[model samples]
Target chain A: MVIATETFRPLVLAQAKARKLEPHLIVVKHPVGGLNAEELKERIDAAFEGLKVEMKG
Target chain B: MRIVNPTYGIAPQGEGSATAGPVDWMNDPIVLFSNNKPNAKELLLGVRDRLSSIRRVDNVDYIAKGSASQPAPPEMLNEVVRKYRIALLALGD
Candidate 1:
């Protein structure tokens, strides 16, 4: 699965389509920069379950 | 850390190229980073650690393009994907 920020979803999806791939993808909140570790960890944690599901799929 | 100001573009080979396709990250994935983005280093490290905790990943690698001014080399990335069959390109702010 590919995890990227929301703002980059278009570019990431475009690349995926061009390559004819249908892999699962996770879109995190946009502007994924300058966040403290706790905040970032929280974001990743929030998506962890979903990511696990995708990984298992 | 070594840094170089390069004049290059890392576009993947076209349709007929030998390495053209999407990689399956389920197996394993190499990582790419945007040096230009704020806190990129921290984010990259965090993501790797988080993924590692979730599961063990083999042959995991990363490419940091150093300060956004230097773009990543696509050919190198292509080689990695061809060899590893997967990649995680971390886009930035």
Candidate 2:
């Protein structure tokens, strides 16, 4: 199930609040193979950006 | 901690004493944090299959990037850890 970037934060927060669950962030690192390290880094950055926006807003 | 990767290993036990020997790391409720979007179905299925083979695991929670969805926020991450008692976390490829 794919959720929109803009809606992810609220959705997660809402879910947590409804369930009374606390949120935790876990960052995974895989052994490089298909994508280069730089590309992976970019992807991670993008994910973080989304998370950051959610936190700010 | 017995960390069994079912995708690459054999099933541990169906029931009884063997299952009670040690904790299965893979079956634990986990928050899968990844940088990029991943095939959730495939990953979830694989995890499910592995967990099903063993009677020890009662629940598994996988949090990953969905289609067109953004990664989880920091607060969300923090909340998950604090709320769910997340036992294990696996990084995707």
Using lDDT as the measure, which candidate wins? 1
CA shift of B75, model 2, Å: 2.2
Stretches of candidate 1 off by over 4 Å are A14-23, B1-36, B67-70
Per TM-score, the best of the predicted structures is 1
Per-model CA lDDT versus the true structure = 0.62, 0.42
C-alpha positional error of residue B28 in candidate 2 after TM-score superposition, expressed in Å: 5.6
lDDT of 1 by residue, B1-93 (tens): 877758665657664423425545555555543455675556556666677865565556666665476666787657665666555555645
Residue B9 accuracy (lDDT) in model 1 = 58
Q: Summing lDDT over every window of 10 consecutive residues in candidate 1 chain A, give the lowest-scoring window.
A: A42-51
Per-residue error for B78 in candidate 1, Å, reads: 3.0
Off by over 4 Å in 2: A1-57, B1-28, B32-36, B56-58, B65-71, B85-92
Tens-place lDDT digits, model 2, residues B41-74: 3333344445455434455555554333566677
Chain B TM-score, model 1, reads: 0.53
lDDT of prediction 1: 0.62
